[model samples]
Target: MSTTVVEVENLSFRYDKRLKENILSNISMTVDQGEWLAVIGPNGSGKSTLAQLLVGLIEADSGKIRIKNTVMDDTSKWKVRRHIGIVFQNPENQFIGTTVQDDVAFSLENLNMPYDEMKFRVDQALDLVGMSSLRHHDPSQLSGGQKQRVAIAGILALKPSILVLDEALVMLDPKSRRELLTVLQNLKRKENISILSITHDMNEAALADRIILLESGKVKNCGTSEQLFVAEPDLEPPFPELLRRELLKRNRNIPNEYMTEEEMVNWLCKSRLTV
Candidate 1:
């Protein structure tokens, strides 16, 4: 049986007391262990607000949030926090330490972790994100993706079961973004960690196991990439899928599952060899 790492039930929130409208209303979702779940929507769709609510950054007006089956309340909020980690949109904003190593060690230090144990975890986390080589480098000297990975490494050191990324890749270049995604993919497979990424990046969302589409503070659609992108003709697919469709229109036979340019190229190469 699969275990649910994070569960939100009938979640709703509102920032202003005077306002009649809620930022998020009647939202419900679950993130299973090791699953990659992407929440996508336009600006002001309550995606960021929902992320904040899940991480206990702000109190929800109505709803329940559970981490690892334990209901989140004031009593268990700290414990619930231990099971989850979050990375924000701005990597520089999350950084406090001057060097890569020090930044990764900051979280463990706050928990009053023993020096030896902290050293071990910091080293382990840096290596996991492929930032060990730049352990001594200043964060200002690192690229945007490298800085984001450092932020993730800080969260990774805590060994949380769930990671919530609130548009963490929005600041990176395309190459760096792809590299970061590869690192995330490896982490998901190797550590079996549940990932909840809230973003407007359709390319990133399409790569996830499931996607939740939010509009006007409500769940507009919820389904897998194929179900949403391939099955729905009215909605536009991601760039890769659009290219794949254009190729198919020209009588080029590409596998239905080959949604990316790289996947299509590899399939074609293998087919040529077999012929």
Candidate 2:
């Protein structure tokens, strides 16, 4: 008896004019509580579209969506949206407030939360993303990575159970990207929030509990990253060659299932025989 948080069944959708060409078809998947699921695909493969669907930004043409036993519909869209927070690929698109704090406070206002609680949540969210120092800075004045952090703070303030990140780490450099990854990992550990990330970064996808591959409006593959890396040699380019040695080296299973660099380092250190 798993706690299924998100349930999508036979979903189909397309633009008003492109009704003939569906952007997503028969897309069905389940994301359980505290599980991180990565949705990966090439450009224009409806990955972004699916993210929009999860948050009710775009309606599904057919089928159903159930969140915590409640069905998704136009009437419940606004209320249902509160349970899911989305961070877009481009941070610029997400900013609506002039200042960082104000931007993060925007969602709280719409949520109609109490002022005192809102203030605390806003402050805490900023702290969570390491943006508390920039709370007074203008959002436009920040760099790309900083803006993305502000965007994340906005969602964090909302305190949604589900976080949908559509290439949220794409803009940041290696350091900032890694830092944000740590922030997300901490949030997951502390809050037990479910994360659904739509990205092309195979390395990032590797970290998720489940990987779903989308291609031209359909699910191409879905499984643990290790399963795909070990079984199918004909996978898409940039396969998991990094884990090949640990996976295929005599033993059938890899020594560790974690996808983090620190975890891998620890595994290597512990594997050595220090005499």
Candidate 3:
């Protein structure tokens, strides 16, 4: 059985005391160790607010959050945050150092880590993000994708058990987005890091182990891709599945299976001779 890295129970929060509305209402969810959980919602649906609550940026008006079974309160939130790292949407806003190495080293310095250990971790993190070659490059000199990777490397330096992505890929172009996703996938497999990705992009959400749909500050649905894809209209199938369905419509006898585009391309090339 997998261990639960995070647990939220009956969580609720509101910004204004006078307002009768809650930004998040009775929200409950769990993220297992090494699992990828995607949170999706329309604008103003409390997705970002949830991220804030998870990272202790804001307090919940009601309910509880547990990280590694440690209950989150004012007293424990600081320790809880140590196990959770967050990466935001804009890469530039997150960068605090003049260069890639310095940016990755900033958090370690705050923790007052010894020089040798800090240097080792910073190097490892930069290498993990494939940014080691650019350690001396100024953050301003890198592309948007590179800058985002640098931000992620900064988080990686913390060696947190969980990573919270609050629309971290929204600012990137298509190719850059794919590259970052690949890096994340590697982290999940290699480091056993749990991922909570809050995204509006269905394609990105489709790649997760499970999806949570939020609307009007409440959970509308939560399930695996196969389950939610049928229940929610907004989530279209990946390109391969779409093509597979279209081919079936034309009386083509292709096998019906959930696959990525690359897999479909290989399948077509090997089994179906007709281009």
Candidate 4:
């Protein structure tokens, strides 16, 4: 049975009260435990605002948010925040420690965790993100992807059940993005961390188990990548799906279904052999 880790009900927010338009209006979503849910939309669609609201960085103007059984409000927001960890767009902006190890340990240290337990968590989190070897290296000296990994390790040390990423992979190159995604996939499988990734990148969103499409401060659709594309045909599809469409245009005998990169490669190889 799946558990609901996070739930937002009729949530509405606005930066300014006089604007008369809510930045997010009647937004309701739930993230199940161990599920990877991606929120994708164009700029100014309130995606980032929703991310901030989820972590209690900003209060919603109306409605409620629940992290597990705890309801989010001014009084309980801090307590609710303990179960959620947020990673922002720029890894550099999030760095606070001189070394990767220090960065990962920063959060645990803030909780006044014991030195021994903190050290164990630091080591474990670093290993989870594949940054154990770079523990001694300065975060400034690391690559963009490495720094992001360190950021994630910092969160992992806190052992948050829900992870919120706000355009966290936007700064990475293609190879770096893929590597980071692979790391996240492993974390999802091994640790069963529930991920809520807010991104504009369709390719990244397509990898998620389910996608939430936000438009003009409201959810336009919520479904798997394939279902969302089928519902909103004008939206850009992932690279593999796009390739499949092009092949179909050429009258190639290929299944018109969404595929991951690996699946696409295997299909091409099989087709070539059969031909």
Candidate 5:
């Protein structure tokens, strides 16, 4: 079994136009296969930059990245790209084919997969994302969530071992978002792929096996979601203002964080029974 599926060492990168300061600095991390890593950070924390660097979409000024034991350098990076796939934030920008099916089959065509196998894989990917019924429809015609599903299927078609999502679900409506997440959860369990999602949705973060929090291009917290939320005295509520207020009502001095609703609910229910 491979313990380290992704490894980053002393990684730092800067935009070509920007000089002197780096967007990411001295970052080192390891992700085991079959792990789900949720990257949470505020705007301008370099989350998107990190994603691009990981998958070889962009090269770093200095550092090293290895995917599934293959080193990434200028010459070999492109070769390594075969195992990495990214689902960017914008659905509109991601859809390249005239219709959803074409877009999903696009990558396999580039890889020169046989015709019979291509259709089978495309159908499987679409079915995983729950977008099979819309395979013939134009990508632009679908709703935000549906479009994201298409984008996901396109990536899944490649059958990469690593999945990078840069806020791919942010634009969807709540119900749509929930539906996609359900689909994603199923994929994760069945595929055993290493998942890295760059997002600010703390609610979604609750579902992650691990969370890496960033601030000003530096790691602020790296631990399981339960660990970081409770590390801070006021970080428990990932939902919104209303939930925070409710937690505080139970105990005037509610500690900083708590992971998942189950943890909070269990505590609150016990506290009430004792009272």
Candidate 6:
């Protein structure tokens, strides 16, 4: 059975206590161990707020957030945060060290971890993120994607069980974004790290194991990419899914389900061969 790593029930939060309307209303969700759950919505949908709440950066007005079966509270919030590693939208803002290797070791050093253990973790993290080659490189000189990888490596060195990405890929170019997503997918496969990615991009959401559609602070839908797209046809889908819909419109006999870019390419190749 899959372990439930994170759980939220009837969660509600607002910046202003005086305000009657809550930013997040009765929000509920669960992220299983090693599962990537993407919470997607437009700006002001409270996605970032939810991410903050999950990591205990901000306290919720009501409801409960449980991390690995432990409920979040003032006393336990610090411990809860230890289980989660968060990467924000701006990688540059997260960078502190001049070199990639130093950045990855910063957190471990702060924790007063033994020198041998910290070095082992830093090296392992860089290797996991494929940033070992750039470990000696200056962080400021690296590409946007590479900087993000370093940021991720810094978090990985701490060995957190869950990773929360708050629009982490929004600033990246298309190729950079794709590359980062590939890195994340590999991490999920190899490290069994549960991921909660709050994003507005359908392309990013489609790649997740499951998606939660948040709208006006409420969860509008929750399901696989195909199920969500089928249920909400008006919503924009990933580029491949959009193309699939367009083909179906022309009476093409393609399967009516969501397909990733590679899957779509393979299907097209098979169709041409059969024809």
Query: Which lDDT values do the candidates have, in the order given?
Result: 0.88, 0.82, 0.91, 0.92, 0.83, 0.92
- Which pairs in model 6 have colliding backbones? none
lDDT of 2 by residue, 1-275 (tens): 65898999999889875568889999999999888999987788899999988888888999899876678899988778778889998888888998999999998898798999999999999998889998999999898778888998898888888999988898778888767778888888888889999987777777788898888999988898867554555554233356535455656444544334556556556666231
Worst 10 residues of 5 by lDDT: 233-242
Question: Comparing 1 and 5 by lDDT, which wins?
Answer: 1
Per-candidate alpha-carbon RMSD to the true structure: 2.5, 3.7, 1.8, 1.4, 3.1, 1.6
- What is the Cα-based TM-score of model 5? 0.89
TM-score of each: 0.92, 0.86, 0.93, 0.97, 0.89, 0.96
Residue 221, model 3: lDDT of 96
Rank all candidate structures by their TM-score, best first, as comma-separated numbers.
4, 6, 3, 1, 5, 2
Runs off by more than 4 Å, candidate 4? 273-275
Cα error, residue 90 of model 5, in Å, equals 0.8
**Model 2 Cα displacement at 57 (Å)?**
1.4
How does candidate 2 fare on TM-score? 0.86
lDDT of 5 by residue, 49-139 (tens): 9999998888888879999889888788877777878998897887779999999998889889999999999999999998889989999
What is candidate 1's CA lDDT for residue 112?
Answer: 99
* Tens digits of lDDT, candidate 1, 19-134: 98988999999999999999988789999999988888888888899899898877788888888989999988889898999999998999999999999999999999999999
**Which 10 consecutive residues of model 1 have the lowest summed lDDT?**
266-275
Residue 16: error of model 1 in Å? 1.5
**Model 6 per-residue lDDT tens digits across residues 228-266:** 988888789999999888898888988877788889999
Question: What's the residue-level lDDT of 195 in candidate 4?
Answer: 97
Off by over 4 Å in 5: 16-18, 234-236, 240-245, 251-259, 262-275
